[model samples]
Target: MLSTVLLRQLTDQVQELHTTAESQLQPLPLPVLNFKPTPGSWSALECLEHLNRYSRFYNAELTTALHAQPQTATPHEVGFSWLGRKSYDTVRPDNGKKHRTITHMNPAGSQLGTEALHEFLQHQKCLLEMLAAAQGTNLNRKAVRIEFFKLLKLRVGEALQFVVAHEQRHLQQALRAAHQATTAPILVV
Candidate 1:
């Protein structure tokens, strides 16, 4: 779970990524980045496509969660430290966790075109807006998850941390995909 401070930090990072990544995203040389040396390899387009897919998923989850009342009280404040690293990269040992696979049900992700980036931006903005609404006591409230990972349910603060951490994980992947672009392709903001 995330503390209030952590949520704020994550929100700031999300905004930063929006600016930096957007500034770099352009479509003039799409085919170069789309090239795959091997059949199993992922191209830049596919990477962005997956991010867009999860962005939609998370957007729906956040919107659905907002309607439910917390079983407990909400929190208004928490503390965070620095924002000195890149996105939360799960594969990195410093990230302190084993990497997990992200599902890609749609094999046709590359064909989505510019709509993929637009979806990602829209979802990120929507997520930040929802996070804003959860300020005040909502931060401390007990969040209701359809399925709790452990015996006890996560508090709202914890949930936000999970959300931010998860987002940071994906954000890192999106950035990593940039490396795989054929000609240093930019992802459209």
Candidate 2:
């Protein structure tokens, strides 16, 4: 089961993510939203699309985990395996370092309209709901399958941390893209 402290921390992070997405991303003009620093880099929309891809997998896993068993009032402390901890650290936002995206998570350069932001917002809301539902759920013991690797699994709490951190990283990338646009005024404030 998830501890009250961990759940509160996770909820706060999710709330911050939602607020950032709404304020920084949703109000941008289309051209600015779509601006990419270079041919190879992702635009704000693409960054969000990339996040949507991961969220699709995670939200499903979280929903399943929530319904998989009954929750308890007794809280369990969250811990991660060495590999999981390392993976979580690596995904955290650090503008100085850029990691190559796996093919599956990479967004195509296709033009995404405002609907992309709406979808991303929806995903964020789902994540918040999942976090709340996970309050008394066994986050450490219950494994959620990773989409990238069939055999790899992260405990529920670890997965939540990774997903939230990954969102922050990409959101930073998106905000950077917005700020760096030459064709449009900065939309991030």
Candidate 3:
């Protein structure tokens, strides 16, 4: 992956994320669960929940990688596995289908609630900060072992790709959830 391309993609993702969160996430009415169609399915809120989780994880990883080798010309890299990949697909579960985080990350099992959005946004902003300060070595260097995967070696460029791609993947899912929330009908009293 190239830095210029990576920056472009990240920039796009950031802008899209801002738009999605500001425009799509907010118009949602309160009690997101109300819009949910089934017990197992995720409401639009849940999609945001998952995105928050995913973003936090990458934010930490990106910060660590950049800090660990601030002077290196090679930017550190991170990679997700096939299992992670499967869980990360852009699937917008209908209200009938449950919209839970896939198995590999479920035990992601952290706090999956409304507050997650705020936390995610903060961390994502931090990631953007680091990205801005990022320079020659940081952008180009590769990591010997991507800690998350535990056994993969990747370039810094690929790591950035993963971060943006992961967000985009979840963003799509969030959009689906939002659509469901808005279009679903309710029985008014």
Instruction: Please list the C-alpha lDDT of all candidates, in the order they appear.
Output: 0.53, 0.83, 0.57
Q: Give, for candidate 3, the lowest lDDT window spanning 10 residues.
A: 87-96
State which candidate has the highest TM-score: 2
- Alpha-carbon lDDT of model 2: 0.83
Extract clashing residue pairs from model 3. Answer: 41-98, 42-99, 73-137, 74-141, 75-138, 75-140, 75-141, 105-108
Which segments of model 1 are wrong by more than 4 Å?
1-3, 32-38, 70-110, 140-155, 182-189
Better of 2 and 3 by lDDT: 2
lDDT of 1 by residue, 1-189 (tens): 334565677689668656645665544355644544346645545656665665555456555666575424354454221220222233232475544444553333346465566666776688778766665445544443423233434454445455556655555554555555544445767
After the best TM-score superposition of candidate 2, give how far the Cα of residue 74 lies from its true spot, in angstroms.
1.1
Instruction: Give the candidate number with the greatest lDDT.
Output: 2
Using lDDT as the measure, name the better of candidate 1 and candidate 3. 3
